[model samples]
Target: MYPVIAGGALSAMTFPGQTAGLSVFADPLIEQLGIDRSTLSLSYLIGTLLGAAAQPAIGRLLDRFDARRIIVVIAVLFSGVLFALSFAQEIVGLTAGYVGVRMFGQGALGLAATTAVAQIVRRRRGLALGVSGAIGSAGISLAPVLLERVVSEVGIATAWRLEALAVLLVVVPIALTLPRPAPASMEVQRTSTGTIIVAGYTARQARRTGMFWVLTGALSTSAMLSTALGFHQIGLLGERGLTPLEAAANFIPQTITALAATLIVGALIDRHDPRIFVVGSMAAMAASMLLVGIVTPGILAVIYGLVLGLAGGALRGMEAAAFVRYYGLTHIGSIRGLAVSISLAASALGPYALAVGAEWAGNFSQPSAWLAIIPAGIAILAFMVPQPSPRATRPS
Candidate 1:
């Protein structure tokens, strides 16, 4: 229960590095730094790509060291990075700031938070993860609104410093409060209920299996398409005849739908095959992309929001559970780390790809429609792939 609470807090804290969180300050930063939107997007692309490269190593470190300590370190560094980012006056400084926040806040801290919860809660693990994700995601969804108020009141630079302070005050203590892990030399540790064995395949062995690629593909598709849509939300919907406020209002339905879907999928994953959720998420992504190509300012826009929310929430709910269920807990960090790295890299590519596509076609519709094919193909592959047996393998 303590781990669950701490994990939820850590997850919520990741908002500082998430796309939705950063989007709040985009307009302000562009104006303050005297840069065009394209230049800012390019910086984000390079920074996120570089940040994505750090996850595999962070994941490996999580497997070898104390996650609680690692999380503490990450939170402190993340806070410092956010503070420094507030002072950036040029592209190079802004890019470096993005690298720091993305690496520490998004990549390392997020992986640690989920891995910590997944490591300790064996029985009813799905419910624990679901609750944790729900809490975190709810906070993430509300971040833009909350930060907007702060930015409006105190200005972007001070808002950033306040956010940094919040991270230090909130995240560090919760991380410290988590229960200590059993010693690494212990193969079997006794919980309050009974003894449990820590077992799972190493990262290398998991990579050799077909299920790994199937799951990764499904997860990456959601990350990429959703991120692309999010990064270009105002512009994309503007092209479809929606005002900026109307486009932004759509997030309310999307966030509500995402919260519901995340909880439902989380509860169900424990009893049902995870592949069902994987395939369903991809289908939702496909539908949303196709819908985005033709959506209007009213009902169609809301429906698009719901479908996109479903895609994002369902995938988020099931991702940790699928990895733990299929791969086991012993080496879960390293295995899931590799998958996260790929997903993050895919997310980096998404916005840039869509931006370039939009430039080529002179509108978002053509590029959005073309992107649908990727997830549609992945959905078919996920459905065709057989489910892996939940057998524990000896860690190397």
Candidate 2:
């Protein structure tokens, strides 16, 4: 559990997963250095994409060695890279540092950590991932205040140095406490370069099928709505008549609801059918958007954030749980990487699309609310995929 929590923490320490404004800092930095957002964004984007593209190779490596050692190296170097980002003075320097930070901070840390958590638990997989995720989110929520306080008291470069040190210190105990891995089974120890990927009908295998595409499309749609709604949450609330501070206060519901729903969804996934929970959550996402579309009340906006946060949070945690439950743990990391890469790519469309729509429509009412079909439609397609008929797909 310690390693699981820490593993997840390392992964989430990215630009977006970081305090959110780290990316915004580039704006000011760019102006001072005479660079373009497109250039910086592209550099950052390509680096992230490159890192994600490496997950399959990483997954294969995990199967071959004691992954804890690799994690240790990543943890140490990741902090060093983040520390370097703070001192970057020019656009070229900043771009180089940013690439390294995202690669270690978000790319390797996140993927490796979650993969570790998956390896450690069997019962209540959702809850395990959720608890680990919560720790990572706590890091994110705390980052804004921490960075501001530190930078003000000292300096930005100093603050980054301190933060990197703090991350290393926090992970020390996790590194010390990781369990000794058992010997690989005959199947796990296969000598030939035979494919670990199975062609048998399974959720992940089906994920490669059209049924999976349907689920992916639906989820991708909902993901887009979430991305838009999240970006404009404050603006939407302000329009509904809350003061800026009060509109900000409305995010409180999200933290509480998301935390609770994550734990509950995990426990439920272990004992019941995961698809039911998934479909229900996606349906809730649709309803939330639809409600906000028809009625722009202040309270409804709060309600929307709360429900969407819970649904989104739960879905994020359950995504792997559902896949593992329907499939199994072998090659889980590889499968999940592809799923996340696709989902994250889809989600990227949200904020950009929302910006364009908000500019044209002058509000979030129609464009924001009209995107309810994604998750709901995915839920219907998820219902179509059959569970691998032979529960005995892999040797226990």
Candidate 3:
């Protein structure tokens, strides 16, 4: 429970550096810099792409050093980045700030928090991840709202400066309290599919397995679809004949369903095989896309929110647990880092892909229907993948 609480707190610390947090200042920044929307987005994308590309290295560092020490450094640096962002006067300044925020805040800080908890709790990892994810998610949800209020009162620059101060004064102190443990000393064993325990598979070895690719593919696809839809949700809802208020109201159902599903999935994965969650998440994603693509508004719309929310919540919980469950924690940081990079790259591509699809098909429904086929196929294939043995003997 302590590790879980720490993980959740660290996750919340990512708010100032995440996309939602940065978005609040977008309008004011653009207005001040005299740039168009496309230009600003392009700058942001470039920065994010570079940051994503560096995740594997960051993961290696986690494996090589004390996570608590690393997290403290990252938090302090992230604060500096926010400070830099507040004083940006040109495109280059914004780009540097974006890189700092994405690389340190989103990538390294987030990775440290989760990995710390995973290191601490071996048996009930599912529950720990579930609680941390839920708390982290709540932090993300509140970030934009909080930033908006601050921006309104103090203005964007001052708001950012305050955020920077909060990170240094609040986040770093909490980070210093995190536990530091020695790496696992368990013996290594090789299996038909992958290595098991202590000397866990390196990122290269992990990628060689069918299970690794499938799990990564499933997660990447989820990230792509979820991010794309979220980016255009209001517009999509309007196309379905919903007023602004109705569309906003749908978030209530989604949030409730997501919270409920997260806790349930968390508890279940600890007791049962994790593969069930993989299949369930795939099915929920497919159901969500199909529902939103075809169903009429009214009650069905709320149902769509529930299914979508479940998919998101469950998928996140499962993905976090799967790395340790299937691959072992010896080098979990490096292995998970590669997986996260792929997911982030997919997220970047999703909006563009969906936009192109909408333009070509003349409506979101057609593209959404097409997108639904991806998870459906993955769901069929997930069944064939076997559960990895927790510890296997080395071949002699």
**If scored against the real structure, what TM-score would every candidate get?**
0.94, 0.80, 0.91
Q: How many Å off is the CA of 25 in candidate 1?
A: 1.5
Candidate 1 lDDT over residue span 1-396, tens digit each: 878877888999999899989988899898988999889988998888899888888988889988988999998999999999999889999999999888988788889999988877766778788888888988888888899999989998898899899999999898888887654333443546665554667899888888899888887888899999988888899889999999989888888888888889988998898888888888899999999778998899999999999998898889898888887776778888888888888898999899899999998888899999998888788768776654432334
lDDT of candidate 1 at residue 190, scale 0 to 100: 50
Query: TM-score: which candidate is best?
Result: 1
- Candidate 3 local lDDT, residue 182: 48
Whole-model lDDT, model 3: 0.78
Clash pairs for candidate 3? none
Model 2: lDDT equals: 0.61
lDDT by residue for model 2 (1-396), tens: 665566566545543333253543544556656777656655554554554455555555554556576677766886787687777777666656665655556555666677677666644667888777766655665566566665567765776787688767765456557776433231121125542432223334645555346444545565667656655666766766667777666567766776677667766776687677678778778776776664444666667768877776676556656665544555555555565556545555566676667678887667656666667677786678765432332333
How many pairs in model 2 have backbone atoms within 3 A of each other, for residues 3 or more apart or on separate chains, i.e. clashes? 3
Better of 1 and 2 by lDDT: 1
Top-scoring candidate (lDDT):
1
Q: Write candidate 3's Cα lDDT for 1-396 as tens digits.
A: 777877888898798867667777878888989998767877877777777787888888888888888888888888888888888889998988888888887778888888888777766788888888888877776788788889989887798899889878866777787666646546344457776445566778787777887788888888888777766676677788878678756767777777777777877777787677888888998887777676556888788788888887887777777787777777888988888778776776776777788889888888988899988887877878765545444444
Q: List runs of model 2 lying over 4 Å from the truth.
A: 1-51, 90-96, 183-224, 291-298, 389-396
Score each candidate by Cα lDDT.
0.86, 0.61, 0.78
